[model samples]
Target: MAFSPLLDELVESLRCLPGVGQKTAQRMAFHLLERGRSGGTRLSQALSNAMDGVRRCDNCQNFADSEICGICVKPERRNGTLCVVESPSDLLAIEQAGDYRGGYFVLMGHLSPIDGIGPEEIGIERLLSRVKSEGVSELILATNPTVEGEATAHYIADRLADREILITRLAHGIPVGGELGYVDGFTLTHAFRGRKPLTD
Candidate 1:
């Protein structure tokens, strides 16, 4: 069996999403065409609007409809601390965690030599400039715990070593509720290295 050309194209377009495979795309296309045409129209309109209007914030490199993101514009967020993350998703996760109240610099990606991404590609210079100009006292390297993420953090730290700011990396370890027996060796090592004393 074959779908009409337009329907097939819709299914193919949906397949471009991260986890939507052929069957999932087909199901979605059928659902939209069968009983969700209005919802699909709204979705299409929203996607078009976002694609056309959204751009990276000048200050943090996060997606924004204006020059700067909402987080960057908040006066209280400028608390002499800057958290560097690899993507907008990472920033959103931290925001959702509800503990951090400082500004952020989204790298958009980590340093990957094979992918040809370098310091300039990830806006390290802009990050450094922001640190210096904003009088940031604590620079938090909140990048992912991958090898490339570690390298990127180290690179940024080395670049800022001459400055007076205090730099720190996010601790990588087992989750609060995780069982030690189920934890991997790498995570165990990190947990041990980052362990803190419970008593003075």
Candidate 2:
């Protein structure tokens, strides 16, 4: 029995998502098919809409419909504190915690020379400019607890030494080598509350 070209293409395309394998993609495709056209159409619409409208926020690099994300544009969040994160999802996690009331600088990724990702690739220069221009009073390095995240935080801290801003990192509650996006809201809030300054 041969799978139809449509199903094969669907499975292949779906497999492109992170952590999704061929079996999962096939199951999802079948589920959508079984659920009928409404489900499929809704899924397709959601995918297309998100892909088409989602763009990096000009201020914080978070996903946004406009040039700046809601967080960046918020009047209350215009304070001089900036939370630096590796991804938009991490930013969302922190937002969900409802602990941070300042702005953010989304790195988009960490420094990975072996994988060809570098400071510029992760928008470090842009972040530096934002730090300076935005009158940032403090920089909170909210990257994950991985080696790459540590390296990135260290690099940014070193580079920003000339600036007269306080630099802090999330507290130890996030767990070693754990990703910020997966951490629960309560833990994330606790981490933010108990954040420690990153000293030399």
Give the candidate number with the greatest TM-score: 1
Error of 2 at 41 (Å): 0.3
lDDT of 1 at 170: 84
**Tens digit of per-residue lDDT, candidate 1, span 1-200:** 27499998998899889999999999999999999999999999999999999999999999999999999999999999999999998999999999999999999999998999999999999999999999999999999988999999999999999999999998889998999999999999999998899994
Question: What TM-score quantifies how close candidate 1 is to the native fold?
Answer: 0.95
TM-score against truth, every candidate: 0.95, 0.81
Model 1: worst 10 consecutive residues (lDDT sum) = 1-10
- The per-residue C-alpha lDDT of model 2 at residue 198 equals 94
Backbone atom clashes (below 3 Å) for every candidate: 0, 0
Off by over 4 Å in 1: 1-3
Cα lDDT computed for each candidate against the true fold: 0.95, 0.89
